[model samples]
Target: MPKIIDNLHEKIFECSLKLFGEYGYNEVNMKRIAKELDIAVGTLYNYYPNKQDLFFTVLKKSWQQTFFKLDKVKETNYSSRKKLKYSIKILYDEIENRKGLGKELTKANVIKKESLDGIKDRLDGIIRNLVEELKKEEKIDIDKEIEERLIRVFFLSVIDMLDKYAKEKENNIKFINYIIDCNFK
Candidate 1:
């Protein structure tokens, strides 16, 4: 049945995500994924041409999911500052979510140039939107390219810091609030 086939596809995706997360992308393989899923190797090949293709499939899906979550919120209702904060917090929330950061990082690493560009395009698009929103409220001046670059630099540094901080044995809202207050202020 079509439903059963769809379920198998979903199964492959979910299994791959967890496998990649538990064992980094380089360490995981078709055999491991197939074994973990109790599916035939042939069945996996039915959906993926090869491991690289499968990894890109996973990577593309991760970006799609992230964009989908951001699109749900209408930025019009909030102040630009609030909207920008919401954007940053929402992404960090996604990154911390078991399904997002761990899987996305694994997904990104497995891909080559084209996929990396695709991921970068999505990120740059988000950053541009955030900057534009702030400009609307005069929170940031649009004329200064230097200020824009500086914001990007600070934002990225914060994200890198959060990525490492989140992996610590202790990760909670308290530290997150501290991050916002200390950095964004």
Candidate 2:
């Protein structure tokens, strides 16, 4: 089992995310993070070797939280296609709701090195499940690999579009539904 961090580490992450989200990553330095945490700069280093590690941890936490939310809403009255649509809509809604809760993806600099592979892997896990369920209902061309790419593309395309729409405060259920309608068909 993995080691659990103490409350202080959690505080560090929370404070860091809040400040980073509000001020932009470039302006939120270790001194600022330390000041917000009410701890010395050296203390945070015990939890994270450096700012990059902290940022990476925050990004991973965000992804995991997103996955958890998706899992909670996995059971719905929609078809597999609709389920996927709802899952993405849920993601967009969460991002919009939590826009200032953490660092903005577009502006995040500390965690820049994090590849899309982590997101891709998590997404593939979801899509694989969807494909399995979808297979039970209809004949899908799983062997050619084209089907897999299409699912990934469809998901990414819709999420990216909805993410773009999220820039405006008004919850764009129509925009979310639009992507859902176009992609999850």
- Number of the predicted model whose TM-score against the real structure is largest: 1
CA shift of 2, model 2, Å: 28
- Point out the worst 10-residue segment of candidate 1 by lDDT: 98-107
On residues 45-129, what C-alpha lDDT tens digit does candidate 1 reach at each position? 8889788888778766766787777765544587665666566666666555533334344344566867667766766677567
* Model 2, CA-based lDDT: 0.63
Q: What is the Å distance of residue 7 in model 2 from its true position? A: 2.6
What tens-digit string does per-residue lDDT give for candidate 2 at 85-154? Answer: 6776666565554444332444434455454457657767886786566666555445547566666664
Model 1 lDDT on a 0 to 1 scale: 0.62
In TM-score terms, candidate 2 sits at: 0.68
Using alpha carbons, what is the TM-score of model 1?
Answer: 0.75
Off by over 4 Å in 1: 1-6, 98-109, 142-155, 167-185
